[model samples]
Target: MIAMTALAGPPADTLWATSLRRWNALCWVLFAMMAVGLATMDGPAGSRYTALALLGSVVLCYAVLDRFPDNPAIRPHVYLSVLAVALGGLAYLRSNYAALFMVTLPHYWMFGRTPRASMGFLGLATVGTVAGSVLRQDGWTVEFFSETVVSTLIVVAVGVLIGLWAHSVVAQSTERARLIVELEQTQAQLSEAHQRQGAADERERLAREIHDTLAQGFASIIVLAEAARAGLDSDTARSAQQLRSIESTARENLAEARELVGSAHRPGQTAAGSVARTLRRTLNRFTEDTGLTVDAELTDLVCDQQTRIALLRCTQESLANVRKHARASTVGVVLTRQAHGVELEITDDGTGFVVEESTGFGLDGMRKRLAELGGRLTVTSSVGDGTRVLALIPMAFEAPGEGEAER
Candidate 1:
């Protein structure tokens, strides 16, 4: 006849509250059956009626407390006190009623707010039941001692052990729930951090693309337009030639802009040919635009598309720097296939500045691009001397798609 209480674990949800309600219903059924049996049993009329009144009072108190669980005025300890008193009075009326004391054990554990409080109420209930039964016999008797006192002590000892075990189970369940919540929160934060890092990498890539392609084309157009205007009063044919060059540069710039925005082939992807032919075409264009003497030795090499693109970009950036600041007349480009990989070297006999002091974005961009391809760039120059830009790339580098899939 042990009663059950609300399980102390995670916060009560709809399912948990529903289960608790069902348990309360079962307790009510047991109490109702006990009341009916007591009414039918034969006994002294006065004692029977008094015991019935006490049972009715206990039922009323339990019902009120259960209905208003959160009411500050109706406390659990008050209901336990009334229950203990009724159990003792019933046991005194008829020694047979001492059996009901066993059924009362769980009520103390269920209603008491703490372990110490529950133990206190349990002890009080046991003493009350045993004392009343002993007094009803009017003297010390072995039958009363064996049935009432000994059995009550055994029940109390077993109930204490069960209560302690239930408390430990609830404690472990609560701790596990707390750890699960913390783990979910940590995973969410890691996901957000990864997204932020991805966005930043994308922005850096776009900035480098704009600097290498569209920015250089626009510079070419500006220079060509100014040259055409200057030569118009002196030579009409040459002025017309310069104007055509401007138009050609403007058109190339437009195509580069569309590719960057449309997410189609990137800027260097449109340059169709081997790495050698690509550098040859770029050198020819530089000579045409700047009228600088160019000595080029290129080797037709086999490599990945990204390697070709990186070499082309490095060549373009080096020539741009020479055109803007080198003030050199002869530009030399040499592309050779080594044992490990391909190498591209561009040297200009121009007035160069100290490499360490230069903070231009073009050089930094080239270094970052080559590094991404498992390559490196080395620039050697000094004041009044020419600058040499060399780029080296590994041949065994993974393709972009293959590398991503493996990860």
Candidate 2:
């Protein structure tokens, strides 16, 4: 397998650049042989001139290509090999440049070529090398030609053998590149999964810590404070009622905190009744705790369990926000089942503040919860005006038979 990290190039160019470099290096070896032939030729003057002219043209093409290695136009062109083959064919007509031709064989199989091209080049190179050798010898004699052909066959066969080996190397490099990309993608997925698992673990850990420490302490303080506030009937006790009210408020906050921590890992809904009953119970509890009146018009809501839980949690969040921010006397809530879906609206005659681009996490969390079940929430409010929150949750209609079958 090819190890790209051990090679040299820009990161994106590694695969093709490395293969092209190897191809160019092999082509240069053929250039060296042609140079040697031009330097020392013992053939007849006419043969020598023809050989030099053909070989020189090949050399000039090589130089042009060498000057522009980064040129995309020249990168994968097989015209270089085609020109060399033409030169070799003409040189065989006069002399023999068959050995120089064999050195050019490696460039064809080096990289980014189809097997069919490789096969065709094998046949072309083999034929050119053998024919060049036969033409170099003056032989109408069968024995001389037979010996020349046998030797040429051995040389060309060896070239094919080595070319096959280099082809295997290119194949390995290609596969190694594919596996490297697969490994990177798999590692990324594993990293994301590990992060998600770690976050979940930390959430569970934080929940446990709150339940064990803050929750227990708050529960104890709330019981003691409740008893203390109830026993106060004297005016002296009533004078401290404001302080006691603060204590009870802290306890109620602790109650809300406990509910959150306790249900941190509860997979599904906590509501046990129809949407109307759950809303009425939540409103009643809000009234008893904060001493504010809430008028609700509710009806049966047909939704999945998760949607039901989402509505209940959003209600709790809205009421909790009102208790903390709204210093008003009355609130209104309405839930109705329409033909398309279910809608819930909560409005309050509170000292509402200006709505800014950034809302607190309370409102954002409610929006996200409803959005998950194909639901949407819209909040409308302004300074000193009332706040209204409307939620629309979509559910697909199921046939009566399908519901009965599931049951």
Candidate 3:
């Protein structure tokens, strides 16, 4: 016998484990009743005692096997053999105890491990019980065959049909349970993947916001500070003006940083003045800081918040690029209300390079921002030539009244 402490009990199938428990209880009840009958029933003392011992041995073997059902050392076939012998002996010892053989039929199906194996054991038990009864009789009598053999065959046939049906049901139920567990695991994995993608998209958005706002501001400060330092001795009045521009750029950068941290505005959306007014203000600031001449033709236009913000950001990014890369003396900004949409164009007479070779983030960010609002950006430039950036956004609103003049 294996040590009880090392055994993990029965299988993990809840339905099978529960059925085994109930089967065990039924076996115990039958054993107790048989033991009481054998103790008091009229029979030869030695035969009755021998039959009682066999019955007790059968119950004890079953109890030990049930206690460590998964133990490798204890084989189920050995128990079935013992049970067959006990049923045959009981039939021979007392004809009244023959019902025990019928009651033990389910044990074959439960422990046989397969339908074929269980049917083999059931046949063995049936033949043994009948042979024992015949050997104790005078001859092959008609009454005995009719009363015992026929009834036992009928009971065996019914048990076989019931066992096969039960096995089919259990197999289907186990398959369904496995599929349900796999489905839940798949759903959890998909949910985790979506969350990771959302986080990645949010990070890309924040990078664009910084590139368009605070980063541009800080670059302006650096340029103004350099100019102020260089002209400090020779051009005192000009140096003072450059220092003031640096201070103003730093304050604007601070505000932009606060807005980013607070998440005050949705990406690509802002609450600002009219589109023309905003562009004019940005152009005026650029002219002041760079000492470059700016010719502006901006018309007051009514549009949605997103459209206005997109146009303003394009102008700002264009001016910043001009300040850093363009060595041009004059810049031109044109804003017009078209038939179906609005357009803003910025042209600079700068030392330009090929458009295809340029891989700056500002131009791409501007394109993406406009694309989100169903707008488009076009850039035309080449070596030794100037650059032109045109942004067009489709809208359905009528142009503002003629009283609203160009800025």
**Candidate 2: residue 104 lDDT (0-100):** 60
> lDDT tens digits, residues 148-259, model 1?
7888899899988877666676678878888888988988888888899878877888888888888998888888788889988998887898788888878878997886
Q: What is the lDDT of residue 108 in candidate 2?
A: 50
- Winner on lDDT between 2 and 3 is 3
Ranking by TM-score: 1, 3, 2
Worst 10 residues of 3 by lDDT: 1-10
Of models 1 and 3, which has the larger lDDT? Answer: 1
TM values, all candidates = 0.77, 0.50, 0.74
Q: Best by TM-score, which number? A: 1
Q: Return the clash pairs for model 1, or none.
A: none
Residue pairs in steric clash, candidate 3? none
lDDT of 2 at 283: 78
Candidate 3 residues 50-129, lDDT tens each?
A: 88788888878888888888999998888998999888887777776678776677678777877889889888888888
lDDT at 302, model 2: 48
lDDT of 2 by residue, 120-184 (tens): 76667667656665666654468755665666677667766766666666668778888899999
